[model samples]
Target: DAGITQSPRYKITETGRQVTLMCHQTWSHSYMFWYRQDLGHGLRLIYYSAAADITDKGEVPDGYVVSRSKTENFPLTLESATRSQTSVYFCASMGVAGDNEQFFGPGTRLTVL
Candidate 1:
């Protein structure tokens, strides 16, 4: 999967705490991604994985960590949460032949106090 990023529907955490948002897909897509949605920037890429154990940073990778040890799961971690990191996170997946087509999961809205 190369096109969709998904996560839980909602989350709330305090500043300086660690948070992990998990994304899961039933289909074994070749590419999976993580993105954050904010007021001015729309959706910005955070990280992406081409396959299990193969991950790369995206547009806004700072303060974030991602891992893909399984095709169905891509987890994004915030080592130490901050108020500026509060936003809606998305998880997406795309098949090999679906050019520019991605299946998106229900987004997670994280609020850091």
Candidate 2:
């Protein structure tokens, strides 16, 4: 496995501002997912994509948008940042099936001020 990585490992932003977190993998995995880690909720799914250009909403996608125009890259954007959205975001990718082990990026810590 080539593994996965994320950009801007740490970020601090104000509420109402737009911010984006980038994720890239070299394994060419068929499935990718975005999730956020919070204090109480633990980890909540934000979005996922089965393939390039094919995406879907996950559990908490209200303030976020995602796109997968290429198999190796999936980026998550917060249209308007909110304090509640501040959390550590993780990007993960899996092979053929969802049951397969998912390779996760280092994570991006976003703090909405």
Candidate 3:
């Protein structure tokens, strides 16, 4: 029984290069979220999708993109990676109604140079 998975738990990239982070959950939850955890700002939402084909921009959507064509998968892409974007990215998912508590994955540490 798999909960959630993230590819390339650690990543290093150069500025202006495109990078993509992958996330997948086996829970088949309806809501999925992407957040970047930094020092001062804390965890800031980047993008989220209510369901497949229904995605919305969150607090820090700039320089990032997300899509959910399937309930079990949500991928985030960095259009042009930047140094300031270096942070730990987390992928979380919640059920439909009961206990809307989010279950977060280990997280992907991203570093931009």
lDDT for each candidate structure: 0.89, 0.93, 0.94
Clashes of 3: 0
Candidate 1, residues 1-113: lDDT per residue as tens digits? Answer: 44344555788999999999989887788889898999999999999998899999999999999998899999999999999999999999877875747888889999999
What tens-digit string does per-residue lDDT give for candidate 2 at 1-113? 36899999999999999999999999889999999998878899999999999999999889899999999999999999999988999999999956688888999999999
Estimate candidate 3's RMSD in Å.
Answer: 0.9
TM-score of each candidate?
Answer: 0.91, 0.94, 0.97
lDDT of 3 by residue, 13-106 (tens): 9999999999999999999999999998999999999999899999999999888888899999999999999999999999898878799989
Question: Which prediction has the highest TM-score against the true structure?
Answer: 3
Evaluation by lDDT, superior candidate among 1 and 2? 2
lDDT of 1 at 50: 89
What TM-score would you give candidate 3 relative to the actual structure?
0.97
Order of the predicted models by lDDT, top scorer first = 3, 2, 1
Which residue ranges in model 1 land beyond 4 Å of their true spot? 1-7, 98-100
Question: Residue 8 error for model 1, in Å?
Answer: 3.3
